[model samples]
Target: MRLSVAVCVPLALANWLLFSLSTMWADLEPRDLQFQSPLAWLALWANLLGIALLLAVLWRFGLEILEALAAAIKQLFAREVDWPAWFAELYAGLRPLPLFTLPAAALWGAWLVLFYFFDHPGGYATDVAFQIAAHALGACVYLPIFYRWRVLTKASSHDPQISG
Candidate 1:
């Protein structure tokens, strides 16, 4: 989890910063824009690659990160928590739908709305800002569900009664 967070956060931030720089450059005259230079193009490709890497990291380690977070939270509140009761409740609340389905669908809907309906004067900066906002929103929604799923899965695995 520490590894996942260490990697994903920096990659996401780098992508955002690169897109911001590119957007700013788009405002300059074509002849003056540095983003047209080969180095800038390399940066642009790097940003794309960073995004892919970030997605891959999340796919590979997202659950592990969430599990670590849950464990930390549980440890932090150990004196106050009722472990058995908590696990019972979590298991009771388990749903048939996959954990990520709702959040992913909502994110997709948000992207569609932003792409088709939002007014942004057709500037690169606006597009970058929208992408950033979408990603932030996705993280906000995804993390909680991830944590919940992780906790439930871990609990069931540790206690065979929960699975039964």
Candidate 2:
């Protein structure tokens, strides 16, 4: 789906940018650094929210791909004269879901927390590891939710009476 490609590519780039910057910052900072308070908790919540938003987009992207495949099959079976036109129509119908902000916010938040939240001399590695583990957990939690949303969206799209 164009929408997915458009949104995800930029997000991936941004993530890389932030990750690099964070690594640089971490390297430059004094070895002895830690958050004055429990800023990791804020990072945790932001990461969770980002995961939720990305899962929603991923669900929509999967559904759009499935719909396009189905449409292509139907068109092929019918021997449609203008397949490109049909595809263009389908692409147009695949409206972009509104979730461009979540990934950015999440990445920035996580970067800040990871690169800025260490006080002890030997805590940086542990904190970074914790961030990684938290993101992994978030992904695990989001998978099922994405699947459920995809199924629901597919069902609702099929029923013509359901509007918006």
| lDDT for residue 134 in candidate 2, whole number 0-100 | 53
Q: lDDT per residue, candidate 1, 44-160, as tens digits?
A: 778777777867776788666655665566566432445554444434433322443444445444544554446335668766766676677556555555566556557666776
Off by over 4 Å in 2: 2-30, 52-56, 59-88, 92-164
> Over the stretch 31-120, how does candidate 2's per-residue lDDT look in tens digits?
644433356545644665675576567656766755667466545543322444334434444432324334534554565455544433
Cα error, residue 50 of model 1, in Å, equals 1.7
- Write out the backbone clash pairs for model 2: 33-118, 33-119, 34-118, 34-119
Off by over 4 Å in 1: 1-35, 79-118, 121-164
- Alpha-carbon shift of residue 5 in model 1 (angstroms): 16
Using all chains and alpha carbons, the TM-scores for the candidates as numbered come to: 0.42, 0.26
